[model samples]
Target chain A: MKRGIAGSLESNDALITVKESDKLEITIKSVVYDFFHKQIEKTIRDTLSELGIDKISVVCEDKGALDFTVRARLITAVKRMEASK
Target chain B: MRRSLLFIPGNNPAMLRNSDVFESDAVIYDLEDAVSVTEKDAARELVSGFLNCAGALPMEVIVRINGLDTEYFSADLEAVVSDKIDSVMLPKASAAYLAELDFLLTEQEKKKGLKKRINVVPIVELASSVLQIDEIVKCPRVNGVLLGAEDLSGDIEVMRTKKGNEILYPRMKLAYACAAYKIDAIDTPFTDVNDGAGLEEDCRFVANLGFNAKAAIHPNQVPVINSIFVPAQKSIEWALRVQEAARQASLKGLGVFSLDGKMVDKPVILRAENIIKKARKYNLI
Candidate 1:
């Protein structure tokens, strides 16, 4: 019983991607994931849970994003993805 | 009217919104050289929305649009040029660009029913543009001309020396052009924001050269630039004493008088009047 769905963190030199879904819809946003990936990942995960969607994916387009920006953007993408779902 | 004009990247929404909080005479919403081509449309949309919602700030607001040669210039012009903003900053501008922008701005003003004229601030970023300073400054719609030191340095392939001795002639010519036409001349941004003392020295140098204002790349530089342009405390005191002497001389119907062993002529009186004006502006009077 996968209530919400899955979230994946994809890393790249210039960007990062996180995907989370309940198998209904998808949303994506890019952020500077520079060296702050850990904080950004946590923020995205927290936002997904808050949206009550267990399945989620977050994607980040990084140009060396700061920790706070990653978190802020991840939260935004999760909220947007969940609402569209 | 911008005592200090802050340059905010056209794409950054947070910075654009936060710019209003920085105490400056104006904030330049930059869309031209600061922004990459791919982000132009998005930046334009975001700034448009921000201008509509941002509360009336104490300073003037302007948008720096892409050059006429850029692919997004037309769209940038169409999206901006509303009555909400105070002026438009044209980068790498020529007299031709001035004509074109003024035409479009006039049309926009008519369509939007704006009461005030939308002024234009052109940047002399290229060698050719600098050479055409007289022609550019003479344009009616053009309010002022700014020296784009970074790009000019790159364009001419000269390394930017900190002292700025390399562009001395160009700066003098620009000052001359602005003075001849009675238009405001603005100095380029001082890249080193950490060097407050150096920045103040540069502001004084430019003010002495007759530049009306100087651009600031960071918020910390704003106060220094503004304070430097203002009359000095000692100078203010002298102006107050001179003004009082002149008032007393007027009571005696003496057009020329001496104050503290100094002969006060018309030019001296005028200088004192100018100082009084500056003092009044700062509430020092």
Candidate 2:
């Protein structure tokens, strides 16, 4: 799969996108970036590691989404990517 | 006594976060049709995480998991059959499915160590299930029955009318079955959010037909359903009068009583007693 996306730009939600890539990369843009950037990144990384998923570029566009929402979106994005190929 | 059960899309966090404050007696987090097939996993995680993390809210929490036939059913139960949820609303319901659900839910409760036994409310939509409603409602785990008119309409090959005549037989069947089993008889939701009058009329019609509660698709419909489903002031007053008359008749050693010059039998007295009980429960008196 080239690309897969999950969630929406709605409030309390984050749009997560996963792209097939040679190396792992993570980028996050959030409304509360300075306050939660590291925390959000840690959540994403912890979730990916826990799920045993690797070698994908992750992009999260956040609108004040909580930890659960972020994790759900990323998991959904990965499932979508896997469903394609 | 859930007068209004608001259906919140399980995938939507904004609504899930504010479920308690919606003025609904119960909130059902929908994991079935409200979610697309692709996001089923995401919704399961999101709902379980939110329910487990958010702690207990004021109102009852019910999760409408996918039917038992689907692959998502067991996963949904694994994620949500916890203390956070008060009940499970099963779509595509049957006695066999209820039996399976009862076993699975009990297993989940034992596995998760949930002290509370999760209730099961089967959505009576399949035509065969409608015919076998009495058997379904008799299940040990069933606490109520929710009428799914939309799917039943299609299953029976009839278009759902504004009057909802297509589902009348099933509605009465559910009402009777639930009454026989002494459980909640919840009506199907009114599809039109914009037509308040139509919704009100529908609620009143079903309430008169013995539906104790109605499902609300939107927040605007909550107040309307609560108003109609709750013991109305007029009925409460009449029930009070009936109780007073019954007390006097019993004191006089009479087996019968009269209210407003009409004979009040055992059934009428029983109905009045139930109304008074409901009013007291709601603190309406």
Candidate 3:
């Protein structure tokens, strides 16, 4: 029911998109997939869970964003989605 | 000795990451006017998380939250209150607002078990607050006062000019009140970011008017503001000589001394000591 995009494609940032869905689904694309892949996924999941969001689809294109930046982009995308609805 | 306080938007990660590199005396992570209504929560979370992770920042970290009149005030405080923050910049500040903020900050400190008390710096932006400047600075947790020229000018129905003719009275009132209270008086930012000459002139004018520091909307203005507020090399040398002479006089059981054939009193000695202290703090000595 809701869809939004937050963040930029610039370095040290993450381009995130969120859409309403029946169940949680996440897809991440990043250059540092080998070393930081799990950490990045956990950050996204933790942020969504903190916001009381469970049914959503997220696509994160990361450019070496830290945990805080990832959380910020994800929360922004979720807020945008909620507002759209 | 805050020569410059740079304002960084809370929602922008790039800006926040690069904040520590600017070398400003203080960096204000702005969550009030800079952050939109919808992204308030996101910005708060980001700032809180970033502060929590930042081990030891080179400069002071101040968080500027929304005013007490807004619903976001409580949440903003909750999100940003932490041991990492050196101070909280309260926008549109007044006596009542500062009192409430002091109470809330105390509660937050207790809740978080913070070892040190966080200071609150008031921003006098409204005409009503400007009228209550004396009372506002007298609040419990206020360590400094910053003039918000844009909002103050708007409130008084005057256009903000680069010449800064309209807001002179309010600026002077705030500076005088802060001086009486022995607190820092910070001037507003020069809005035109591209005008280097104008920024230098404005900084000199405010610094000469007894302002302790000036705010910067951009990082590039930080160096200019710092240079203008810092004591000149010749003045530093003069202060050093005066201090040394005073020390020798004190050892000789004298309350006054002659420096460069001019009578130097206790007040003059104190001024020289203060100048040297500022110079040392800024690494100019």
Q: Which candidate comes out best when scored by TM-score?
A: 3
Kindly indicate the candidate among 2 and 3 with the higher lDDT. 3
What lDDT does model 2 reach?
0.90
For every candidate in turn, the CA RMSD to the true structure comes to: 7.9, 2.4, 2.3
Find the 10 residues in a row with the least total lDDT in model 1 chain A: A1-10
Each model's TM-score? 0.77, 0.91, 0.92
Could you arrange the candidates by lDDT from highest to lowest? 3, 2, 1
Q: Is candidate 1 or candidate 3 better by lDDT?
A: 3
Residue by residue across B1-285, what tens digits does model 3's lDDT show? 588999999978888888999989999999998989876877787788789878889998999999999998998899888889999999999899899999999999999999889999999999999999999989997889999999999999999999999989888999899989989999999999999999999988988888989999999899999998989999899999998998899999999889889999999998898899999998898
DockQ of all predictions against the true structure, Cα-based:
0.06, 0.59, 0.52
Q: How many residue pairs clash (N, CA or C atoms closer than 3 angstroms) in each of the candidate models, in the order given? A: 30, 0, 0
What does candidate 2's lDDT look like per residue over B69-147, in tens digits?
Answer: 9999989988898778899999999999899899988888898899899999899888999988989989977888999
Quick one: best lDDT, which candidate? 3
After the best TM-score superposition of candidate 3, give how far the Cα of residue B11 lies from its true spot, in angstroms.
0.8
Q: What is the interface RMSD of each candidate, in Å?
A: 9.6, 1.4, 2.1
Which lDDT values do the candidates have, in the order given?
0.74, 0.90, 0.91
Collision pairs in model 3: none
